[model samples]
Target: MNERRTPAVAPAALDDIDRALINALQGDFPLAQRPFADVGARLGLAEEEVLARLQRLLDARVLTRFGPMFQIERIGGAFCLAAMSVPDATFDRVAAQVNDFPEVAHNYRRGHALNMWFVLATERPDGIADCARRIETATGLPVFLFPKEREYFVEMKLEA
Candidate 1:
């Protein structure tokens, strides 16, 4: 496996309000007609301010993703972790090809024999093998699937 070195990125600076907002959002988000307004009211901010701050954080790359996580298995879907040993020269291209699949939840690089790892969330359990085969055909590399044998829940919250 080829190790790719990436430049270090400086951590984004956060103000007190941004820190508060990040902490609050980690828990249950209010279900309301104007959710931002509700959040703002709790933090002594206006709706527009809350929206603006969140947008700014995202634009600055301070936040990579903000969204809901659903249990695909409960809905008759499947999530599989797949990996491939991509040649160094074609790693980026293969990553792009893999990401083109709509079922891919996220893809990341690792420093191992199987360096390219990604998660595939399909609408059906059998779709896992089908998607892996499609990826193998597309990338000309074998995809290794590791389906979960058991599930565990971990609550993770980071202070901004």
Candidate 2:
């Protein structure tokens, strides 16, 4: 049976170098076949060292899965920014119900009227709407879906 996998580790505190790596990597990544090798070269680290450190960061849950953001709509795939106005009393239960879907890539608590937010990725363009309906039916909370209206290539950086 195919099962959903969740991060297992209690994320470790990052040192200054790790912080630098994370912040720097948020910008442009090379499109070459050996992109990590190119990234390592620019960062003054060996390719093997870069891979090891990246693995450590991932294992520690400091970084989620790394991948390119494609224009999914153009390719007939889909992604949605979804949220639920979950009550405080049943927040965990609602979150678990929503996360049970393979389509929900990740979800986190937020400080807002819509308290539980997540990103959903699906293979088909209609999958986001379907997942939202299923989650609403299962959790008894209205699922709000925000499909991307436009794609922007911005150079903004978030310093860690």
Candidate 3:
């Protein structure tokens, strides 16, 4: 859980096709036996070419992940968005401590007072609160839990 992620930037070799592919596929991914093939057809790309390009993107850390967004509660899981006000001097150390938990999906350093934000996912409803307390104990910082009471479907599209 302490493992750091490779820098999340598209490689310099990233091209138009990659950008277009990211944008096109971000919104709606077709559910099929060969979903990549279906997407390839729309983009005028061979199935293999599409798969290769996507793999390259991932290998280069351009895409952290590509998959379905699951509703955790339906699958006997739970998650929460949490943030903390980490001091500038201890940000890196504090972040590392926070990320040490297996339940932390990912953490981001943002340009705000509450600069460190992360998602915690677990297999049970109470796990979210437990994680917050654990993180607070580990980092000596109060965790602001922002759990969603109502679900919102926002179709976000990014052009690379």
Candidate 4:
């Protein structure tokens, strides 16, 4: 079995409620105008405390992004992962073009045959191929599209 290794971050400084808030907010937040207050009440904390801790967490970069994951298909949106064999000579320029698109959520340089990879989410299914074409034109390199054939559910929990 092959296991991918992820670097361990030094434990972040946090309080009891901060830790508890991390655990509680992992699954889902309550759907309400005062969502933080609702979450705080359930976790036995004040709304301001919950909000403050979340802000701290954000500032610390412990959470890269926190938002809703939409049912893209149902919502008439399309998504895919793509890679490019970006040569070292022009990687920076190519990467800039790839990242220029508003549809690109995030891109990373991986050490592999397909060195540059990114996830693209767009308004329609056709946008996947269109974005690939646009990227190719902008970067002057062939972009390979690798759409997900199946979905894998990943569960992660942090205990600090």
Number of the top lDDT candidate: 1
Which is better, 2 or 3, measured by lDDT? 3
Against the true structure, what is every candidate's RMSD?
3.2, 5.2, 3.9, 4.6
lDDT of 2 by residue, 36-143 (tens): 888888878888988888899887766777667677777888888998898888877777788889899768887789888888888897888988999999998899
Rank order by TM-score, top first? 1, 3, 2, 4
Per-model lDDT: 0.85, 0.79, 0.84, 0.79
> Candidate 1 on 51-106: residue-level lDDT in tens?
99999887676776687888989999999998899888888888878888989855
> In model 1, what are the clashing residue pairs, if there are any?
none
lDDT of 4 by residue, 33-95 (tens): 999899999988899988888887876756656777776978898889988898878777777
Q: What is the TM-score of each candidate against the true structure?
A: 0.83, 0.76, 0.79, 0.76
On TM-score, the candidate that comes out on top is 1
Which residue pairs clash within candidate 4? none
Better of 1 and 3 by TM-score: 1
